[model samples]
Target chain A: MTQTIIWTVAILTVLGLLLALILFWVARRFRVEEDPRIDEVEKAMPGANCGGCGFAGCRAFADAAVKAPNLDNQYCPVGGDEVMQKVASILGLTVEKKAPQVAVVRCNGSCTARPRTNEYDGVRSCRVKAALYSGDTACSYGCVGCGDCVEACRFGALSMDPETGLPVVDEAKCTACGACAKACPKHIIELRNKGPRGMREFVSCVNRDKGPVARKACANACIGCGLCARTCQHGAITVTDNVSYIDFTKCKLCRECEAVCPSGAIHGVNFPKELDKEAVKKRIADRKAKAAAEAKKEVPNG
Target chain B: MGKLTFSMGGIHPHDSKFARERAIEQLPLPPVVYVSMAQHLGAPAKPVVAVGDRVKVGQVIAEPGGFISAFIHSPASGTVKSVAPRKDLAGNPVVHVEIAVEGDEWEPSIDRSKQLVTAIPDDKAAILDRIKACGIVGLGGATFPTHVKLSPPPGKVAECLIINGSECEPYLTSDYRIMLESPKEIVVGAAIMQKVLGGCRCVIGIEENKPEAIRSMRAAVAELGYPGIAVQTLKKRYPQGGEKQLIDAVMRRQVGSGGLPIDVGAVVQNVGTALAVYDAVQKNMPLITNVLTVTGDRIPGNLQHNYRFRIGVPLSFVVEQAGGIPDTAAKIVSGGPMMGKAVSNLDATTVKGTSAVLYLSEAATRRRPETACIRCGHCADSCPMGLEPFLLNRLYKAADLEALEKHAAQDCIECGCCLYSCPAGVPLLDNIRQAKGQVMGVIRARAAAAKAAAEAAKK
Candidate 1:
């Protein structure tokens, strides 16, 4: 028995050594010449693999970044500029600073504003609900309120307000990853610039119905009356398809259009003080009157 | 002599056909009617008439917009109030022609007499044209343009024409009522369709639960002595009225995945479509009226009705006429309980294929809380299309598109059999429907790409 054990140990050690040599040779033959900087770039990433960078994961982004000549096309919305800076420093490249953005729910059709016309009794999914029919409210172009966006959010940034029956985004936790925006079947959630001091003005309602029909459906529907467009000093506002849109790039945030909006669909968020509606209205009226007077004078001179 | 059923899976939901005995009654015309252009499948018809134009009943108001679309005729003598986008039953924006009813006058071209014209016209093209001009669609709820279905592509021969009288969905009796009331016309319609399909053998498949309909149809076929026409009894099964399911029950054939009924040498039409064909071909009457059943367990027996309603009448008006919405009603479905859409807008008017106004109580309609699947295999067993709903559901949640397509997600008939049979109360049909759509989209895109590549290679 002792001779058998000694022989078994000796044979096993020899077999193990043979296998290790084969593995070493195979690894050398199949070795891929990868840039070591890829590992560094991946280490610099937030490692969330949220796909907010439009890549499969942090590893894929690192692979692409190391291969790319420059980081012009790649961006990580979740990591923002700081992580990008780390990645750029590791790669010895520079990236243009992109303005930080946040998702904004474009619908303001709260439960009280838009009364439920019918009960939705289907799978608790916004995609399923939207595919089945319009929402419980008559305003078809509003939030489905099924918490699909909340489910999609990886950062715990979105939550449904039971009182309003609408999703509220917690700006502090939001990373503008755009997963929630993509999950919204109604296309009511949009990513916009988180402006200087986190202040921004945007048209909160996406309703394209006519004035009377929109007003009848939801109290806060944007009824393309063009009052906001006419009131804007900057040529930022335009009405298309019976819906008013404000160009963020051109908007000066004077808040004149917000005061002139009849349906209160234009929202100004993170402002230091509440808007003085009457005063702003008076200022817009005065400005319109002055413009009309100047146009009359020019006509007389011509 | 055994009762006929499909070879695969099916479920027997309680047939809550409360209004089966109700005779068809003509509903009074509403003062204003909103006729939707999207009454049939395919592209919505384009309106030919403008606001303020006077139209007579049976006059063409909207012309077919695409090859697969149907014409839209005025259901009443009225002045067009407006032609604008309006909300449909699902609250989706569809173009509508609003008209204010003035009188009961009809187009002089239409025959006002109730006489049944038995002579089968020899000209197949003329018969097809008449059917198209009259806007006759499959009233079994799919509303596919009948003209499109009758015209089979080259190299494909129709060996069997199945008239669906199964009325397999619970709480729907419009087809049953028509079979009992106008069996002769339905048989004639079948004969006409058979003639159009190159003298194919015609079989009318009715569920065993509908004994009266089956007996009446059989008697009508016998009296008419129409050659190559027979009435076949189908085993009572949910979704048996589906085009593929009915064809399977009658022809003993299975439609291949991603293939149409025509591919298997069979064509299916609803019994209701047959009646409409008789009207369109024999009387030159446009498909502007249809029989709809208003029923539910909560509805009073006397209040339940099978009304022959105009195409553009509002469901609310019909409900008001047949006793207002029941207090116990929790949900209103536009068709049968199994596959019908829940009605979201009552003010939205009825279209040509509107089958029923079902008022289900909360206890009867509410979905049970979903629990963990117990792996009982009931869903797969009951799937009439032979789909694995549990596996599909898991794959769908995982978003494994390639695996979904391999499992034939596109072949799902969306009959809700899996959902009905599942003890876990999982929303099997909902997820599978979405998966099917996604898979179909992928298949279509791949086909389009292949075609594009072939064209490029040729160039």
Candidate 2:
């Protein structure tokens, strides 16, 4: 019995040693050489895996950062400039700083402004509703108000406002990951520079119908009268398809376009409220006086 | 009798058909009608008439927008009040042609006589064109254009034409009324469709609960001496009228995942659609009217009505005619309770596929609180498509798109059986429905990508 036990133990030990040696040889033979800097770059990454940098994840971005000739087109939007700079230093490359962006809902057609023409009773998804037909409102271009963006946002930056029937973005929590923008079926969400002091101006209406039709559908719809575009001194605003767009890069926040907008579609948020009210009132008075003078001149001609 | 049923999973729900015995009544024309342009599944028909254009009944008011679209005809003779966006059955905004009723004068080409024209034309193309011209669609709730369904893709030969007389949905008796009242017309319609399908054998499948319909249809088939046409009685089951389920019950063939009924040499048409086809081919009449049942358990006895209403009539008007919205009604469904959509806005009007306006009381529609799943597999047993709803629900919660596709999420038919059968009151169908949409979108994107790659390779 003692001799059999000794033989069994020796044979088992030999098999274990042989397998370990083979495993070691295979590990070395098929070893893939990877850059040591990739691990450091990944460690510096925010690890959100939000895919805001057009990469699958932080590890994927790190791999590409180590292999790419230069970090020209590669930048993490979530991390802004700091993470990209760290990655660039680790990779011995350089990356240009890009302006931090936040998603902004481009529609201002509240329930009170744009009355619901019908009710949507199908799947409670904005994408599904958008695919089915126009929304409950007559303005087909407005938000469907189904909270699909809120559901898609991993950072909890969006929530549907019950009163306005629109999504509200929390700038503090928003990483400008572009998930909400991509999830928007109507293309109603846009990523723009957060602006100084979070002050931003944009045309809040997406309706492209003619003036009369647009006005009939939503009270705050852009009529494409070109008044705001003409009023912008810096040429920051342009009207196309009966809708106006504000170029944030060129906008001076002068509030001229907002004052001149007849439908109140051009909106400026986080600006000085008292100054805005005063300027708006003054603009209205000036418009009324001009119209009266023109009418008087036409009457004399008649 | 050993009744025929689909071999897969199904459920037995209470057939709350309170208005089954009531005969169909003719509803008076409303003051104004809102005829939606998108009553069918495809692209909305483009408006052919302006706001102030005078339109006669049976006149084409909107033209088909695409190959799969159907034409929209004026259901009433009136002056067009407005052509603008209006609310549909589910309260979604859809472009509608609003007309103020002036008179009920129909187009001159329509034959208004009460004679039953049993002789089907030999020209198949002419029959299909006439069906399309009349805007005939599957009235069994899926408003697929009949013309497109009749003409299957090449290499697919329809060996059997299944007539869905199985009004299996609880509280829906429009098809039953059609079968009992217009048996001759239905038989002739089936014969016409069989002729269109190259002399394919026709089978009219009705649920066993609808004995009167089966008797009447069989008698009609015998009287007409229609060759290659027969009547079948199916077991009373929820979703038995489902196109796939019905095909399985009758043909004993399972339609493969993501495949149509024609893939198995069969074409199924609703009995109402067949009746519409008869009118379209023989009488040269358009589908301007349909039968709808308006019933509620809490409603007064006299208030439950089965009306043959004209298309484009406001549902509110019909409800008011029945007894003004019942105080007990907590939810109003556009179709039967099992598959119908909740009426979010009553201002929405009826369409070509409107079969019933069901009102469920608060007690009846109340949902039980969801609890932890016990792995009971009841949902799996109840799913008519043999899908594991509980597993799908879990995968959806995990947002595992890859696993969802592997499990064939797109095969879900959105039938409420899993939800109804779950002992834990889990919303299996709801979660699965959303996941199905996501999986289908992914599949479509992948297909498009592959197509593009193939094109590039060819170049």
**Candidate 2: count of backbone clashes, pairs at least 3 residues apart or interchain:** 3
Q: Per-residue CA lDDT of candidate 1, range A1-302, in tens?
A: 99999999999999999999999999999999888998998988989888888899999999999899999999999889998899899989999899898999999999899999988877999998898998899987899999999999999999999998999999999989899999999999999989888888999989887778888989999999999998887899999978898888788888988998988999999999999999999987787799899999999899
Structure candidate 1, residue pairs in collision: B9-B384
Q: Model 2: residues >4 Å from true position, as ranges?
A: A1-24, A68-73, A89-94, A105-168, A183-189, A203-247, A257-267, A283-302
Candidate 1 versus the native: TM-score?
0.97
True contacts kept of each: 0.74, 0.07
Residue-level lDDT of model 1, residues B229-272, one tens digit each, is: 98888899877988888878888898998789999999999999
Candidate 2 on B285-384: residue-level lDDT in tens? 9999999999866777687889999999999998988777878887888888888987766778999999999888978787777889999999999899
The residue-level lDDT of candidate 2 at B386 comes to 90
Runs off by more than 4 Å, candidate 1: A1-9, A85-94
Q: Which ten residues in a row have the lowest lDDT in candidate 2 chain A?
A: A272-281
